[model samples]
Target chain A: MKNGIWVSKNGRVSEASGLQPRDALLFAPHGMTSEDLLQEQRSALQQNIKLIRTRLAEATRR
Target chain B: MAKARVFISSVNEDGLKPLRRSVFRVLEGLGHEPLMWEENLGPWPSYQNPVEKCLEAVEQSDLYLLFIGTRGGTFDAAAGVTVTHSEFIRAVDKGKTVLVWADAETKAIFFSGIAWKLDEYIAHTVQESGSYPAPMQALDFLRSCQEAPPHIDPYVWLLLHDIRQRGIYVEDLARGVETDWRGYFSDLLRRGLLLLPLEPTIAENSNRLEEAETSFDLLAALLPQVTLEPPHDWKVWLNTIRERLQGRTIEHRYGRWNRETVGSYEACNAASLYRRDGDSMRFISCCGRASAVRSFALNDQSSYIALTYAMGPRAEQVYYTESGQKFFYCVRSGPFVATFHFPAGSSWDQLRYIRYKDSVVSAIIGPNTRLVKLVRLLLGGMRA
Candidate 1:
C-alpha cells in the first residue's frame, strides 16, 4: 500500500482517496492523509497475495 | 475480493441505519458475508441466552467491524456494558481484528475539546441519578454517566475518549460526508487480507484467485467452496482454544452431548470412551447450573466423557496426545495439560486434525471438515 494510485472498476471517485482523521489513528504519521497509510496496507496485501500465488504455482507444478 | 465474515456491530440509531444497509450491500457485492447484529443471527432455542447468540456471532466472524454512533446502546444487565460494547470487548479479548468506526464529524469535535464545553453545559442540566453499570477499567465512562445533561450525545464523546485513552486505535473512524463509503469499504475488503489474524487458508485462496482473470473465473473457483454454518453446540471453538493455549489461560465450556449438538464434534459417532478415575464421576457435571444433577456434566471439575460416552464433553480441556507416528493434537474440555508435539516437519494447521485410539478422527485437535479447510483456505488463512 506504500505507493500507487488505485482506480475502482465499479467507479466511485477514486481520485481523492478516502482519509480517516489523522489524530484518530495510529501508524498514521503527520502530514500524510489516512489514505496514504491505507495505501501501504493495500500494497502489502498485493505483495502477500502475490507471495501466496507464487507458492500456489509451485505447489501445482509439484 | 477475499471472502470474510464481518461481524457488523452498532447501536440501533437512525443515523446508522443507512450505513448498515449499504455496508451489507457492499459486503455481498464483494463476495463477503456480513453478519448483521440483528436479523441474520440466531437459530438458538428459546432458553438460550441472547448474549450467547451475539457472542457466538462474534466468535464466528473473521472481523469485528464496529460502528459506534452518537448514543449508547441497550445496556445488558448481566454483562454490565452496552451489548455492543460487550461484543466489542469480546472481539478485542478474542484477538479479532476490530475496526472501530465512529461518527467522523463527532470524533473530530470531541478531539477538538468541545466535549468539555458540552459537559459544562450538561453539568447544569444534570439530574440526580444512580451509577451506570460499567467497569472502570473498560472506560471511566462513570464521569460521563454522572455528568451528562440530556439532549447532548454524551456517549460518543465518552466513547471516543474511552477508546482512545484505552489505546484502542480509532483510525478507521471515517464515514459518509467526505468519503464514498462504498469505495472505502470495497478497497477495505479487497485489501483486508493483510489484517486477518492468522489462518492457514490465506495462501490457498490467493493462489486460487491469482489467475481468476474474470469475475466468472472467480465465481467458478469459489463455487465448490463450502459455506460453514455456525456450530450447533459443544464443538470446541478452535479459535478460543488456540488463543487460550497461547495465553496459557485455562477455560471450560459445557454443552449437552446429543444428536442435535454435533455440529463439528468429530466423535459424533460415539466410537470410544475412557474409564473414569475413582475420584472422577462416571457421570459428569459442568459449569452452568446450580445443584442440578444431569445426564451430562455442566459445571467446574465436571468429569469429561469422550468418544463412546453418551454425553460429549460438558467442559473443554486442552491437551496434545501421541498416536504412533502422527501426534494427536487433542484438546479435552475439562482439564488442561499438554506437550509440544508439532515436530518441525508438520504444519500446525494441517496437523490440526487428530486420530483417536479407535482410529477415527475424534474431538478437537480441530474439525476435520473439508468445509473448514476450504473456508480457511479461501479466507486467506484468517485464523488457523
Candidate 2:
C-alpha cells in the first residue's frame, strides 16, 4: 500500500492473489517518460505472473 | 552496491522545481532511493499525522539530505519549531548522515534557524573535533556523503559495504554502544584496533578496488594463518553447525538445566552486524509470541551470519539454558561475537553478558596462551 502496490506482510505481492490491472498503473502515472513506461510495463507483467502463480498454488493446495 | 534510502527535506513550495528535479535525477542516477514530500506523503490517512510520519522517515533514512532555501515553511505551533527545521534537528540528534546543502543566500533567513544551527555545528564541534567532515554545499556534500571517509580502514570498509547492502543503518552497527559510525569508529581508534594515519590512502584506494580484492585483502590480513573460504549460504551453515552442537549435547555442559529441554531456542538479540544511516529493515508484526520469536530469530540469525561471513568463520558456538529463561546461543567467530541481548532483557544484564563473554574469549585466545588444556577444552566443545 505504501508504494501504490498492494503488498503482503513480507513486503512482496501475494502470489495467491493476482493484482488488478488498475493497480499496475501505480508506477506508471501520467506524464511518465517513455523509458519509465517501458520499465513499469515490465514490472507489471512480472507482478501479474507472480500473482497468477500464487493463485495457482493456492488453488492446488485447497 | 546498496542504494541508501535518502530523505530529501526541502521546502516543496519554494519554487525550485529545476533544482529538485536535477537533485532527484542525480540521486536516481547514482542508484539511491530519494524520498521527498510531494511524491510521498500527500496521501497520509486521516488517522495518522503526516508531520510525525515525515519525521519518522528522517530518523529511518540512511542519509538525511536537506536543501535549505528561502522558505522557512510552516511553523508547528504545538512543537514550537518549523517542520523542516524540526526534521533537520531530529536527523542530527539521531546521529544520521546529516548532509545540509543551503544556498548562499539562504543564510539570511533566520525564521527557521536551520542555517545558523548548521553553521554552528560545522564551525565549533565538527571543525574543532577534527574528526567529522565539515558541511559543504549540495553537490559537493552529496558527493562527499557518497564517498567513504579517508580514515576508514580497508577491513572496516568491506564490513561497512557488505552490511550496508543488507540495509543496516550505520547507527545500529554496534548496537547498545554507539549508534552512529562516527562514535563507533572513534571507539575502534581508542581501542587501537583502527589507526588513522596522516593520509589514509589505503582506505581511499580500497573504496575504488574490486569487491573480491577488498574482501580477500581483509581476510588475508585478519586470518593470515588460516585460509577460510567464505560460506555460500552462511545461515544454513550456521544452523548446520548449531545442529552439530545440539546433537553432541554440548549445551548441557554449560547449561544449568537437565538434558530435557522444551520451548524454542529462538534468538533473543537482534543487533545489526553493521549499522549505517537510513537503513530500515521491516518485520511483519503478528499477534503471538511465537510469531515474534520467528521474526526476531530471522533478524538475529541473519545478522550473525553476515557478521561471521565478514569476519571469517573460525568460531566457537555455545548454548546456555535454565528452567525458566529463554535458551540462547553465543557465537564467537573470529574477532566478532554475538550474545543474547534480547529487546526484552535489561540493559545491565546485556552489558554484563557481553563483558563476561568478551573476557572469557579474550583469555582463552590470548597471544601468550601456553595452556594446551584450556585450548583443547574450548576446541573440543566446538567440535560437536
Candidate 3:
C-alpha cells in the first residue's frame, strides 16, 4: 500500500525502498540529457547485482 | 543484428523519396519494422505538430537511419530546428544506433569547415556590424564560389556537426547533388518529380527526376494493416496481469521519466489520465490532406496516451490511454508482452485517479519492445 514495499517470492514481506535512484535513472526518457544513458545503465546494472545478492542470501540461508 | 525497428529520416522529400520506399521494402522484407511518417502515420495529425511524432519514433526505434542532403525538412520555430534535425538529436540522445547516409555535399559540409566558418562569419558580422548580413550577401560569403550549395537551409551544416560530435560513422551516399541548379526549384516543378525511382537502398541519392506520381506510387506499398476491434476478454486479460505482477501494486511515484515532458504534449490536458475530450485529430488531418483514407483512419497509431510503471525489479506495466477513459496496461513478461486494457470507467476512483495523473512517475519500459504484440497492441479498438 505504501512506497518502498517489495515481496520476495515465498510469501515474504520486506520493507525497504523500491528501485534506488541508480535504478530509476536508467529509465530517464529521451530529450533529457541522454549522454549519461550509458553511465546510468552501468549504475543500474551494478545496483541490480547487489540487490539480487541480498535476495539470494535471504532465500538460501537456513 | 536481431530484427529491429528502423526509423528512416530525411528532410529532402524529393531527393530521398524513392530510397525511402526501397529502405521500407527491404526492412519489411527482413521482418524488421520500419516507421515512416507519411506511411505509418498519415500526414501527422494537424492538431499536434507531426514532427513531434517523428521524434517519438526516433525515441522508440532500435536503429535510426538518416539521410543527409541539400535540403532541411520543415523547421519548428518553437524547437528552433528542422524536423529531420530534431529526429537526429533525439536518436543520439536516446542512444540508438544512428546510421547516416550523407551526400557528397553533405559529407563535405560535415568534414569541412563550412559550418564553423558560417557560424563564425555570422557571429563576427553581428559583433562588428551590429546585425546579420543580408541573406544573399551571407550566402555569397559562405564559399569562395557560389556556384554550388545554392540556397541551402543553414541548419543542414549544424545537423552534420551533431553527427560528428556523436562520433557516428557517416556512410557517404557519394551520389552528389547535380550541379545544375541555375534554377532548381523551377526545374523540379517543370519536370514535377522529387527524385528518380530506385531499387531498395539505404544509401541513395539521384540527380535525375521523374513524374511526380512516381514518388507516391509506393504509398500504395504502405497500405494500412487490418484494424481490429477490442477483444471481449480484456477484463480477463488484465486480471491475469494484475496477478502476475505478483500482487505488486506499483506506487505511482517510482518511475524515472520526468513527468514534466509528458505534461508538455498538447494533448495531455492538465496531464490528466483522462483527456478532457477526444481529439478531432482522431478523425481528420490538421493539415486538411486526405486523412480519412490514410493510416490514421484506424486512429490507434497516433491518438492514444502511453505510460509505463516499474513497480519493483523488472516488474513493469505499460498502460494505454484512450480519450476520457481510465488507463490500462499491456504487461511484459520475459518473452511475451501480454496485451490488455483496463476498462475505461471501471478503474477510476476520482481522487486517486486524479492524483495518479498529476504525479510524475519513472519510466518502466526502456527503449526496447518486442514486435510480436504490435498487432493486438493498444491499437485494437477502445483500448488494447
The DockQ values of the predictions, listed in order, are 0.03, 0.01, 0.02
lDDT of 3: 0.44
Q: In candidate 3, which residue pairs get closer than 3 Å at backbone N, Cα or C atoms, i.e. clash?
A: B46-B286, B255-B361, B255-B362, B256-B362, B256-B363
Q: Write the per-residue lDDT of candidate 3 for residues B1-384, one digit (tens) a residue.
A: 334578888875687877777777766765778888767854755797666777887887877888877776676766666778788879877667677887776677556667567556665675478565553455457545332265666556656755654557777775543322224224533442332222222111111222222443343233233444544654343333333321112233211211122221111111111111233111211111111222221123222221221222123333323233423333332222233232333343333332343231222222212221222233222322
Q: Who wins the TM-score comparison?
A: 1
lDDT of 2 by residue, B1-384 (tens): 445677877666544545666566666666668877776656688999888899998977867866554454665657645677678767766656665544443322321443233334333443356333322222133234323233321122222222223333332111122224344334534643333331245434434443544564464355434444544543443333332222111111111111211112233323212111122222222211212222222233233223222323333222221212322323333333333222212221222222233222222122112222222223223311
B244-280 in candidate 1: lDDT tens per residue? 3211111111111101111122211111112233433
Q: Which stretches of candidate 1 lie over 4 Å from their true place?
A: A1-62, B42-45, B114-149, B171-182, B185-384
* Model 2 stretches with alpha carbons more than 4 Å out: A1-62, B108-384
lDDT of each: 0.44, 0.38, 0.44
DockQ-based CAPRI category assigned to the predicted complex of candidate 3: incorrect
Name the lDDT value of residue B272 in candidate 3: 12
